[model samples]
Target: MASSLTKDSSGIPGSEKTFFGHPRGLATLFMTEMWERFSFYGMRALLPLYLVSGGTAAAGGSQGGGLAMTAATATAIYSIYLAMVYLLAMPGGWFGDRVWGPRRTVAISASVIMLGHLTLALPGQGAFFAGLALVALGSGLLKANISTMVGHLYDGPDDPRRDGGFTVFYMGINLGAFAAPLVIGTVGQQVGWHLGFALAAVGMGLGLVQFLYGTRHLNPRSGLVPEPLTREERNRVLRRTVLVVLAAAVFYGVVVVAGLYTMNWALVPITVAGLLIPVAVLVRIKRDRELSDGEQSRMTGYIWFFAAAAVFWMIYDQGGSTLAIFAADKTDTSVFGWSFPASWFQSVNPVLIMALAPLLAWIWLYLARRAKEPSTVVKFAAGLALVGLSFFLFILPLSAAGGGKVGPLWLVGIYLLQTVGELCLSPVGLSVTTKMAPAKYASQMLGVWFLAVTAGDCVTGLLSLAGVDLNTTGVVALEAAVAALAGIGVYAYRGKVRTLMGRVH
Candidate 1:
């Protein structure tokens, strides 16, 4: 498993320890991810704002106008789209582990992502939905496999630099994110939405090109299928996939024919499936005879981490939907007598991340040197608490505003706090997933890790359908309380989780 999962130091590009004293492959992955995130966050920043613009020229021009969707409808679509993107990572991981190797899978998936963004550049409602589906499919395939390849650049399971390496990679993601809104968001909100989408397409195209050019730097083992399926197993999987597709087609056909199809109704199954897949994955891992008792026990501890992540993302990801709305409609975006785009607020978190990730990385390394580093569980708790506190900060502003707009600093502060929380959890979660993964199901475990995000987005969608008023002080307070309590709960149980984790930490 370790052989498949990590490269020998000899495999590093020229073994010179370039790219911030890590493997040279890290630079290639970092840039590729940067552009992919540029495309993704560029489109994402505008999606909610566009959806709720209600096609009114007052919001933007007629050319730049949106689908005229109600707030609930927009929220539902946004949540479902995000949920699907993460949800697909599970099957994407399976394909990487069994069919295509991680390197090949990434290359193929990136091409698909470029095509998706191109489709989005076209006009019409049909094109919009189709393009979204393509992007989600491609992103699902690309996400986990690429991260697995990153893990492959390291020397061993317990490599001290693993967490810092991921943090650097995460910085690339934020760099792209920081630039997207200023470019794509401004164009989408001012010039035209399709033009912005076209720019996003260009970003993905650049990413694909860079990735292809840099493949030589990646670990050669990333191209090897760790556990190839037999002919019989392949045939069985093919048969099941076809059957599932057909079943889905027939079900949707029936719903459309029966006049029972609506956006909200369409989302119910996705939300339900998103919530259930993680549980099913955990259950399957627990019952797998291939795993030893120690592995299963580690998985038992992982359940707690998984739940904590789901809770964190549930609040954190709302920055796109709920918070974006708050920014546009209720928060003043003026600075130095120049009004900024609401979508530009999307850039704030990424900018903060770019500034702070290196410092946090240094702090982690520094703490580790003294054998006084906090456990992963404690970091997760701190992250959860900080994000909750960000929301808690919103209460005073919203309550004091009394239906009027508040200052921009309020949102900036919220994003700053969430940024800190993300630093604590997101990259650490990625590093830990590689460390604890079972050998046979290594990439799939990464997929399961992303299911935590899927579950969070599913609940976000469900909350929208339930008509929770996101702007209400009461709702904000409740969300803050849930996150804070979850953080405290995990901190209290840190000892038990460490025990279950066996030797991993």
Candidate 2:
């Protein structure tokens, strides 16, 4: 049986070669992730604009096409939704490691995600929030497992193809992300909101179909448990799960009965959990006696990398929130006598990523052969600084426009800088996380990696509560300084971090 196959073996038994000289399974995983991202980014592109469109509030809703939420409320919901998506990845990874395995978990979660999008296609505010919750749950479950499956495709830790493979995979992500806004955004903004949501549902359905069909190409190990729980452990987990569910039900009933159910009230616990989970995970890893002293040391350095990533995403993710708002309200939509949808601007970063990722991948490979490749720490520092610079550059157009609409090229330039920064950090971080992970906690470690994003997104949501316009000069300046300072700090201490990392790089 394929489940008995060795993890190091590539794909489809003897027919291992295909898909750009990589494993055939990569093509399958690639397309699956592509369609999933199409659904994800499609909804993201439309969400902010839809929230404020009609200027009505169901709980707070739109005109004919939106929920009509205030800008602050919509931004908070967007950030919270993003946070929850990554936040649930922790348990998702645990389930993959101990219960269902990555392949099964991915399949199950993808089905749930399709349902979420479909729910969003339904009319009414209740359906909207329900759909977001469903998507968050399913996406969180699907994301870490799928990426872990990709890592499983390579031979081992030292395989030269691992980083390159991840880069190719990252490109698939951008290909989907690039197209989503153009298609989904246009429809959502111009047609009906629910129709745009239905398109997202179709994309996810397509992804699931292809994923199921292509499972044969994947390693059989993907379907087998890496660390199955003992009977005693399983019983304990079941009891705890039941208790948690009951508690949640009780809380929901109490809130509904008391007439105290508000969206912000619901967000509070989620926000708190997002802030706490990464720290809890780190503490758990630190306390684990199974790891060697060297492994523990590497984790110390990983903390620094984690912090840098959180800061990067805190700013970078604004492309769909604050920056999207800026594009809609303050940027000139006309180019060459044509006015475009503001959501179309969201496509800029992915398009840049699609164009540049291959070039960066080749450059990294070239540098590695010559022993001149930058350390992961160096790359991270560069990424932080570049993102900071992107925000800082926004000051120029802000000054020139004097509160009037700026040309679209200004956004293009900003996205260009941010895209390069993402290349420096994101794919590199994924590869490094896989390499540095302790064997017993492989999938869980990836979950922890996603927690960086969760932390950043949670902070983004909290910032909305401060009532600061994210597009203002003061806000932009502060953001730029923080990232720049972090980059400088990381660069200054790279030597020490390298020592902690030992030989991993």
Candidate 3:
């Protein structure tokens, strides 16, 4: 069995040959995640626009191709969908750790995600909702495990290439993200929404195929469950898994039957789950007798980082919801007399990340060599502050436009700032989680880290419900002010957080 394979006496597998000075497995994981991100972001770019579009045949008319939802409703749905995607990571990671292992879990996830996109290409609201559910579930399974696998590629905590490898892997994510909006967004907006969705399905199919073909290159350890269950325990777990799935199905059915399948009703439960799960996980970690005091303190620091991350994402993720609407309705898409699709704006951040990732990776390594690297908490503070400033930047263009369409450059500038923020915080967050989490619950703790994103998405949903117009100056300023305050608050506590982190930074 591949899972039983081990390194030769030289401590290297035949397939462990270097790629860009890292293991060959990095290339495989990189391309796999790239395609997955392409599929995910491609589909997402179309969602808000599609929801509000009318299913009419009028060119550029809002009346012919969408569900005809209001901006608030559509934004709310988008936020909830994103929230669920991260929220389910908890169980998905647990399943990988306790049952399927990362390799199998990732494969299953890609397959389901592909199927979900295909289903969305079909007609009817029923298909739409079902497809969203499947995609969310699949994303939950894939997201944390892939990152965990990247960490597994390194032999030890002290591996010098670990951070660089993650940065490279993150670039793959952006590569896919960069292409999705250009390709899928154009197809969905101009060719037809269904065709765009079909393209996304194709992207996932390619990813799964590539991953299956390249599995041999990965470390064999990645394929085995961390702690396999006993035969009796496996049977019990199987039964419980079935029951949980069935119960979820019944709940959705009841919601539909009760005519409560709207955004407002859905937000209530999702928000509660998003907020409570991380808190519960933190409490569990604190009470675990197996952890040393140092580990506990590190976990406490992680929780603080998690809170700041949630705040950062609450502002950053508006790119798909509020920002998407703004691009479609308020921004000038014309450049050199050519009008671009609104969804293409979604590509900006990824494009920037792809361009900047290598530089940032080098910078971090350079700083480390000089013994001047910023602590993880400091990076978190910088990221939050940058994102807050990005929001503030929008105020300038909003004021200048004064109810007229603003130049696309304004959005470009905003994305540029936000990309810097993402670079500082996101990859760092993943690395820190792996370093700090207890060995027995590594993958689950990663899931807990992602719950910060879940919380952000839920909060975004509520914020969207306020119905703030992107073209309005007062609302834009208010958003900028609030984000700035949050960023400042996090930075102010950097000293205390650094103390908690101890030697992990």
Candidate 4:
């Protein structure tokens, strides 16, 4: 199976390469990611408004979607959804590594996500909530494993095209992110949110078909079936599954009680318990010998990077939450005598990502040549700092609004800065996983990385509760706290992180 999944470091699961400058396998994965992201972000762009829009107020609190939810409620729901998706990525990663492999996992996930989108597009309340759940689970699975398959594209540790391939791969993700909001969000605003959900369903369907069609080029190294497990391996898998299920239960409870949409405050205890289990796992890993010395060190560094980056994400992903609402509710969007819908502003970040990704790739390449390239830790800190700067940009127009509308250009500017910060941090973090993680534990570590983003997203939900009428000082204060906390964490962990990184070429 491994031999069949292997490619000549250019194509997909079972094929050879050609003159297109990339493996044939990468093409399908590329479209798969693109459409997956399109489905995810397309729904994402409209979710805040759907929750806050007047037609659906009963399920939401007086401050949330069905009601005239304060911007904070919308932000809270957005952040929660984002967090859950990332958190589920852990299970998704494990399922791929232990059971399905990346290809099947991605395929199944895409199908599931399509179903979720269909549910969201249905004509009633119960379907919408249920659809959201399917979407979260599907995304968690796909987001974790798709990149794992990409890593499989390279046969060994020293493939030169791996970095470039990842860059191109991430570009696919951004391309989807870029297009989904414009297409789906605009349609949602025009026809109804249901239309946007339907579009997302179509997008996921497209991604699924693309994946099925391109199986010939898949990397031959995928779908590694484990031999029948011994007692220890079997026990370990069983234990981990139990822990994961328990943790997910708890976290869902907390998120539900806190969210206006899935108002299930009844689960707070479960959420608290869920939050603690992962920390306990880390503690066990620190004292356990299941990992090699190198594995131990890498896992330790991952924990910090995961946590620190989560802080960055909490602040960074606000683009979809607080910032989305801000654009919708308060931004002055008229242009050429046509007032632009706030949903359109979601396009700004992807555009900036498209623009900045190349420069970041070049900057890293230039630095690598000069032997002056920053370590992953350094780059991550810079990401945190850059996102911090982006948040400050909001203060100016937010303050100037003074209970009046702020110009949409200001929101555009903020997204540009945020997109640059994401370019610096988000995709690079994916690269860091492949670089630092040992093959034996790669998928697990990827899961950890995603979990961190999920944790940060959870915090974003809680923090979004801080205010709806956020003024310039309030926005500044919020951002400053995030920046300072992230900066301090990064600095304190600097030495350990470098030591774990070893000498990279």
lDDT of 2 by residue, 263-351 (tens): 76777778878889888889889789999988898888899999999999999988788778777767888899997788899899888
Per-residue CA lDDT of candidate 3, range 1-505, in tens? 1221333223466643565667678778999999999999999999988887872211244436578777777877888899899889887887788889999999999999999999999978789988988999999999888888898888776787786788779889888999999999999998999899999999999999999998897889889999888999989988998999899899989999998787656666766777677778788888899998888888877888888888888889888877787788778898999988999999998888888877897899999999998878778888988888988887787677655778899999999999999999998998798788877776467777888888888877766666645336676667667667766776788898888888777
Question: So what's the TM-score on candidate 4?
Answer: 0.83
Expressed as tens digits, the lDDT of each residue in 1-505 for candidate 1 is 1122244344543436457666778888999999999999999998888777754312332234578776666777788899999999877887888999899898898888888878877877778888888899999999888888888888766887686687678788889999999999999887888888989999988988888998898989899998889999999999999999999999999989999887766678878888988888889888899998888888888888899999999999989988887787778778989997889999999889888887997899999999988899999999999999999998988787665778999999999999999999998897788778877777467778889999998888888888777768998899999999999999999999999988877
Sort by TM-score, best first. 2, 1, 3, 4
Q: Which ten residues in a row have the lowest lDDT in candidate 3?
A: 1-10
Instruction: Name model 1 segments beyond 4 Å from true.
Output: 1-26, 55-64, 151-168, 289-291, 365-372, 435-440
Error of 3 at 391 (Å): 1.1
Any runs in candidate 4 off by more than 4 Å, and if so which? 1-19, 55-68, 220-262, 266-274, 290-302, 434-440, 464-472, 488-505
lDDT of 1: 0.85
RMSD of 2: 4.5
- All models: lDDT? 0.85, 0.86, 0.83, 0.73
Each prediction's TM-score versus the true structure: 0.89, 0.90, 0.88, 0.83
Ranking by lDDT: 2, 1, 3, 4
